[model samples]
Target: MITIRPSREGTAVAPVLVLAQITSLQLGSAVAKDAYDHVSPTALAGMRLTFSAMIMLVLVRPRLRQIIARQWRAVISLGLVFAAMNVAYFQAISHLQIGVASTLELLGPLMLSIVLSHRLEHLAAALLALTGVLLLTTSSASLSPLGILLGLLAGLCRAGYTVLNQQVGRLFPDWSGLAVAFAVGACVLAPVAAVTDAGAVAEHPAVLETGLGVALLSSLIPYALDMVVLRRIDTRTFGVLLALSPAAGAGVGLVVLHEHLSVRQACAIALVVLASAWSVSRSPRTAPVPSPAPVSAGDNLPIKDTEHQART
Candidate 1:
């Protein structure tokens, strides 16, 4: 299991946390892409959600009854968005190369980090990311306009997912929010996937195995790691980690799939990653979003216990 060290009395590494999340996320996506030809993206998405739901339920055992009725609508909305994002992005990967699809999807986080962010540094970073995206994408006119549009939609959904997850993290605490979200996502996606993929995904043992691995890599491991990191790390650190997604995707694609990226693409990834980190480092928190009931206690630890630790 990953660990979450206590944050320092007055410091936080939110940027770094974002960076780590990006790294794991891109790699997971790359891995999932390898399985696309083997099974329908919907099937893969359904299985991923199902496993994630199971894992989260077993780990958190959240009190569903305690959730306010007012939040149910938001929960359902998040689930649908999450399911669509997963399925659509996966399907996009089947058509677009990892570097391309991931770069496009990245626009979501960059836009999100920018729009929600007021820090000059983060805004600059967002601009840098935009430039990098342009370079990375313009290199290949082979990109289908439809694929690009789909990729954009995926990015929007992902941003929605990010916002919803933030809401969940604030309200639920620890892993409970993630767990509940995954459960709902699974609930929404499974039936649709069942109807869509039907028997095609079943008869192929290799496809099933690939799909399972994709689910594990894409959903289960990365999320659990992210929660642990967030509990231990800060938002800026998280954002920094998030910046690494493109690079990670490129690396995994090259190393595992032997799909090398061009010089321009590599530079674009670097520029965005560095800018995002630079931006997040300068951001200041507006206010503390309420940590969920389950994870909230950790946030209450005494200052003395975390002497000279990482930021809040």
Candidate 2:
């Protein structure tokens, strides 16, 4: 029998890299939140996407020619979704706590998983997540209704991104599709950037640096690390680790943003995380093996077919 196992390097590197990715993402959001005093939410969002797109374009240099005419719709849709998600995310954090916003936005992918799931465990998981989100949203007074709406909208856009990313990933290689999608996001936000008083961002050297840091930390570094980490870990392990995102957000929010969560809110976040892990754990693993082919009526046998059957 042949045995296959995860490589030693993968075993050691995957978890650490994923942790780093989560840390970078949450820390980047914290930095963006701090910079809000200097720039509008939309302006900051535009700066992040625009600069990140420029960086990705220079590094990836995606070949536009490789994208077929038929795939234009998918490419454009993915880009639009990306732009919408980020814009709503920034707007959400401006009004809501970073942790709260992230947890609510997580509803998108969680609901998507539940909708497509066939297992009872996954359904249970969905309910758990839903309850958690409701608790978090209802218990908070500081968050405005518009902020909550934007967070949910961001979640919906996130679900769209998840669905479309698979299609475009198949259509392009070397992550060029993501680069193209980012480019499209940059284009989509160009008007917003032009209209916003970006001069405030320009005048403050610290804000500009923070904007660049947000771009690199939030988009470029984490995404680049994700590509590498995905190749090194199994789907189950990856999904399980991804469940830590909300916790990471909350932890970072407390430390960096000084956002405090009540006991009930903390429990709700735990429920959401557990639900994500449970859903991933309950996914159908290996496929059932096929039965052996039936013996032909006319096939010669060591013993007669009837006699052999009786003996067995």
Candidate 3:
């Protein structure tokens, strides 16, 4: 079994990778939003997953024969999560401002982190994040009910993705699992797009070209970066780090899509950010490392040590 030791370089690079991920992901969302004129959200989501799957499959060429049934289950679960999350998020942004949708979506991971920790501090952070979401949602008369519902759905799927990704990471020595997951996601979304927006793609052939860029920026780059970061950090830390997303989404929305946020909305995002910072600050500087366990031949793969210093 592969064991990952913590290094100072790993600790320092994790946050930077997260920052780059946020930028790339938010920019992709903005691009997708702008391209909505050419394609429906479902169609665009399908195209993104399809292109991502194609690129990853060609590049990684995962050995399907070697992956065990248990590993297949995890990869399939993650793929379904990806499909659901992307479709819901794309729908949410079609109705709501990208920033607002992102903030609402973040609740899933924030709540997940709090539930996993079951500490007073994490609870406090959740409450603060909830308050921010409430402030952002209730104060904005422009927010759509459907958008809110979809954003929450996306967030829930995102939480599942985070947990499942770690499991997949342990099951595979490399990115083979991710490649298979993307293919699964593509298969799942293809039919949905055909039923929901079959005519959109035909009407706007250029959307396919745009989809390639969106897939790279939104799905490929950010996801690959996320996998790298997740290998070095625990789910809780990863969730908290995503607190930067709302602000990044806001800035990208404003700059790229010309979607503006009100003062209260900005304050709400700030509250969420502060809560994330506080939760991270409250985490223990050191965690007890568990002894390595024996692995069967079927499960021989690298395992991430969640107790690593990079978790901070």
Candidate 4:
């Protein structure tokens, strides 16, 4: 695997990029929710992936001919995860409020963090986040059970996506892997969208326009930023930073979707946020930077860099 040391510049910029990612992501989700009346969640997800794929492919133009078998495996795995995660998540937000769906979906990464943790404090952090989830779930009697289940499923897929994406990143050493993954995702979801909601997009041409916006805000921009940020930080740190996503989602849901959270729900989100912050505070101030992998002249493959660049 290629490992690149985190530079001072990359480290400093990571948090800012994450903030922008979450903000854009939440805003995109809220916008997507608005278009659900005209399009099914599956169709919209297909559109998002298709548009994102086109954009990334054009921008990165990955050298498909040069990709080795192992790299192809990683990229394809990540693509499948992406397809599953987006479909489940979009279905989730259809039933649950954006904030609530986001929080529930976060369990995937939180669980991943816990599994990877060797320290006691990390367990404590997990407990706190679980408590928050429990509170949020119990607080709302109106939440759809289907939404809850879908959200959890999305979380599981998200965890897989996180792991596989980092692997693909290391394999490709650039965004080329991501571009190919997006294409794979689009291919996976397009047929499902056609089977499930074939007429929605045709009937509502406006769905295409809104979908482009959603693709830009939710998929392309944030995912591109994710590639950049993942190259600069550890997965645990990345997961911890994602603790802010619930709050961002809540804000966007309120402002854009007019979804109101009860006091208990608000407190629940706060607890999750607090748990993430606590984890970060207790973590080592600086991670050990590994030396970059040596690039061979005959190797046409991109060099993987930064073992620490893996994410939640």
Q: Write the per-residue lDDT of candidate 1 for residues 1-312, one digit (tens) a residue.
A: 222233452125554445555566667676667666666877888888887788778987877775664345556676778788888787777777777777778777667776755666666777787788878878777878877877888878877766665445545545656777788899989998889987877767676666566667777777666655544444433443455667777887888778888888888888877776676455443333223333223244432212122244
Q: Residue-wise lDDT of candidate 2 within 169-267, one digit each (tens)?
A: 444546676788878998998678658856876677677677789998887787667655544444334434454567788899999989888998888
Ranking by lDDT: 3, 4, 2, 1
Candidate 2 least-lDDT 10 residues = 303-312
Position 170, candidate 2: lDDT: 40
Candidate 3 accuracy as TM-score: 0.87
Residue 170 in model 3: lDDT: 62
Q: Distance (Å) between predicted and true CA of 71, model 2?
A: 3.1
RMSD of each: 6.3, 11.1, 4.0, 3.7
* Model 4 agreement with the true structure over 134-205: per-residue lDDT tens digits: 788678788899999999998898778777866676666668889999999999998898889877778889
Candidate models: Cα lDDT each: 0.67, 0.70, 0.81, 0.81
lDDT of 3 by residue, 169-235 (tens): 7667678889999999999998988898888888888889988999999999999888887766667
For model 3, the superposed segments whose C-alpha errors exceed 4 Å read 1-11, 284-312
lDDT, model 4, position 216: 97
TM-score rank, highest first? 4, 3, 1, 2
Off by over 4 Å in 1: 1-16, 225-241, 285-290, 294-312
Question: Residue-pair clashes per candidate, as listed?
Answer: 39, 0, 0, 4
